[model samples]
Target: MRRRGMTRRSLVASAAGLVAAMGTGGDAAAARTARSVRGGAGGESVRNGGDESVRGGGGGEDRFARGEMRGVWVASVANLDWPSRPGLTAAAQRAELIAHLDRAVGLRLNAVVLQVRPTADALWPSPYEPWADCLTGVQGKDPGWDPLATAVREAHDRGLELHAWFNPYRVANHTDPARLAASHPARLHPEWVLPYGGKLYYNPGLPEVRRFVQDAMLDAVRRYAIDAVHWDDYFYPYPVAGQVFEDDAAYARYGSGFPDRAAWRRDNVDRLVREMGERIRETRQGVRFGISPFAVWRNAATDPLGSDTRAGVETYDDLHADTRKWVKEGWIDYICPQIYWHIGQSAADYAKVLAWWNATVRGTGVCLYVGEALYKAGDPAQPAAWQDPAELSRHLTLARDHEEAAGHVFFSAKHVAADRIGAMARVVADHYQDRARAPR
Candidate 1:
């Protein structure tokens, strides 16, 4: 992405706000400095550094505060991020994993959201699901060692928290399950899944389906030493333009009190999220529960209290995800909004959404971590804001204004590995160079 350089007019406009606040008094000046530092769209460490250096704060092990979380997503589907070249020897896989962890350790990041079960498959040994095809050339053929166990063991060795990322409702991503290995879950339990929007997803409205997904996922949580349980933005599969999610039968049978099909669909997800949180605590108290939902929940046009964006599809209306409700109700430990846009874009402005999220997370203990769009930072089609090396830098700086904004987690690991436009160097040199805050 080719971003525009910071304009003098924009800088002056930003300074004007700071100056107005500072003119009040010494206390106001300190607050203004903190706000100005927080208001920039820079990296978190750089923004936090201004706060620390300005206040003449001391640094030590004390800098690593308790209850802080920072991580990157390790996607397995299509080999999107890690395990760079697929079908590499087991030794190569292990080596690549170590290198990724080394970067995270060097950056002082505390967590790795590795995709163990990208689809309805296994990254570790399981009787219920077959081995992930993304791992080995063919499905059901093991890639050698149990990936989850190896990932957990290796991550712990380097003092990094490993979160087992799971796609709760997704089955065969795009291809038909008849094309899948005979032993794949979708083939074995065709009745449990429904094909929708050119992809197969476990019928969310079915109780048996819900229980099965939880059982398949919780098995890993109980067996592995994972530090957190993570689910991403694919809650009911982002709505297809014209096609509807084929869950009519599941809802007709399951829906009793719900008035409409939409409400029933949302309740199914609510059940899964609420029940999953309770179950995680029941199984592993220390393992956190987090969801990175779509950036906009709803636009103010739809709801009076919604965000000021004109996003056509929102998590609340289109995807049946009450993301803000979950955070307000304390159903999740952390909320990572995929605020992947520029400063003044018409749809889903990054800065506006970040402020909305910070304000929404006011009373709840839920932590807010802006999910960086690392992939777009160098892509040609991305907005002008992403091209600037300092675009993401300014984002993190802006987020620091919120006390609840604990830290940041970029989308995937490989993009940063490329060091596109020196984005990685800027982050490490500026902030993560120091010791990280301790785990909660």
Candidate 2:
């Protein structure tokens, strides 16, 4: 099976105007994603993420802030990057997680964005959600240890920030609720669930469902002293060919005079983003709320403000995620757009997208982190570009040209340790030689 990777937008005055039109309903529910583009597309060197002196890994516990974000994701779903497999003993799981964090430190990264809630479940026991099936291979069964607790302690000891990751609306990877634990929220409240593309998602359009999902996620926030609240590109699920997300009933019941279903759907996601941001701020003043959205917000042909990419699947029209608006409205602390393509690729050129995002995040107080696709490195199945030993490093080299390009986060942990084709080695040599804290 193919492993799925991460993917994210743009600017400020017109943004406020757009938000005003979207209505005050989003005021309480939005994520902290405001942004602006005062500068043009060229990148100046950023401070925390240095460009010079790329050698040596013994940058021993640098006391000063680097002002850049160097993070690695430790995905837990289906054992993509951790635990090796489901149902591992509690001691074994703890050891595996610690090893992943140690690997991050070895690579000179300062943050571990561990997925605490992959697929609408919790790594830490939660009153509102079931124990993650990814850990024990059975929903609601404890792995006999609190992964989040161990992660926070270990990451902090290494001077790394532990960002709690959540997949807000996903209930199950498959459509049937029978496979879910009997006490799972989806099974208890089937009305809030919708099946599309063989997966069950809590309908984003339903106000009650949105609130429930938020409350469920916030349970973790109140329980853990996490550095940030992180989400990925799963807002409305990637568009499936010939398959429609059946939410006509939701639209008819609550869309309330919106001209089209698309507008209503986008508003639903907007509310979720806005509210989550407000809640995070209220709960923990410094805890960041951020997202790693799909690369293309829209093709240039689709929207005059869109990036110059032509591949397909947009965040706005297809996934109902207004990525640009989130950045513009100050609904997120950071936006990590997974620019997982080669420098000169035909569909989505990495250089072009990087320039566009740097320009977009200039004045918004929101940081920009490039989501590097380390998983693709040295993979023969990938495009010929990734086959090059220096492909990943070249991405870092290009990012150095953008001032807003605060730092880079590799897709998952295992790939970085594997150093496939020595691609990761090249990136470290060229960009991460000096130990740096995650960009604030």
Candidate 3:
């Protein structure tokens, strides 16, 4: 998720101060120790000198070599992270992408989640959607080369797993269909589109819309050697304040058996996840499916099974994404919840939430990777904890206690590069001394 505006100078100074105070010469030694104790991805366990055992919720043991998923999200919507901005030459765009990948490798990270489809558009050649506007500043205008294809090849060459990220329903940031490409699917099928909260979305209620989106996203999975298929938290467009999603027509048409509108919406998202997972496996047996959902599923005050959080928004109730159900049913290969909060936050403490998710994925055969808010670190608008360079590093230190906490993915690539508060560098110094492969 994007954040409020940030000035780089002060944050940089803060990071420098922290580094100066802590000293940096011992980072290499610390990392070596971490590798030895944690066992570099797929390495022999330090304890039993054999495969590491993952204790399941049902008290079963699933054995595998210990590995961590150290990933960073490269957002493409509105050119937030890559291409620098729209209309850059293809050569320039490729250079910027290569730089991001190189930076990830330098950081000892193992995975890259590139947003190929930010809105209802494609970053590669697709029969289902037009070219992403972030590539050339004009929807449908080819950017002279395929970004996804290049990303997959370049990332793999650098020994990094490239996960193709897609936003399932978001069509456009604006409500005007006229701004879209002439052959845009949303424009082609008006009935499938809905204007909500100043943005346009393909109504999730329609069966055809769901199937078409699955087809659109799965196209890349079939065409490229992508490591995984990834989806962010935008399932139903976090409830708009005072405005409705306005999917009544499709709901009226297909909401026959569901308990209510919320249930029907959740079922729509569930079908998308379950069916997409099935198709991904069929398309490529080795390809994994994952979702990085909003951290809280439901506050304990609302549901007995929910996390002990007082979060204002719940994925289950507000966005109609039954994140917990998806994990229990094993619909996704991994669940990386965006626990974007501080350690001791009153509303939703990071440690408490991490524990909740650690338990949620246990025994389910699904990997759990915490999504870190790299963007928040040192941001003046954020809470005081974010101002501390050690804040993000502390998050990793905290995750070490959870057996199910396989790894973590930072919010974005730009922050990884900026290391504004030296937070990313602090994390590298403190926790990521040894590079770990993404969990299988």
Better of 1 and 2 by lDDT: 2
Q: How far is 281's C-alpha from truth in model 1 (Å)?
A: 0.9
| lDDT for position 391 in model 2 | 92
Q: Tell me, by lDDT, which candidate is best.
A: 3
Q: What is the per-residue lDDT of model 2 for residues 173-248, given as tens digits with 9 covering 90 to 100?
A: 8988999988898888898899999899999988888998899888877777777899999998888888888898
Q: Tens digit of lDDT per residue, candidate 3, span 1-51?
A: 000121223323333444345468434333322222232132111111122
lDDT of every predicted structure (CA atoms): 0.72, 0.78, 0.82
- How many backbone clashes are present in model 2? 28
Q: How are the candidates ranked when ordered by lDDT, highest leading?
A: 3, 2, 1
Q: TM-scores for all candidates?
A: 0.84, 0.86, 0.86
TM-score of 2: 0.86
Backbone clashes for every candidate come to 18, 28, 1
Q: What TM value does model 1 have? A: 0.84
Over 4 Å off, model 2: 1-66
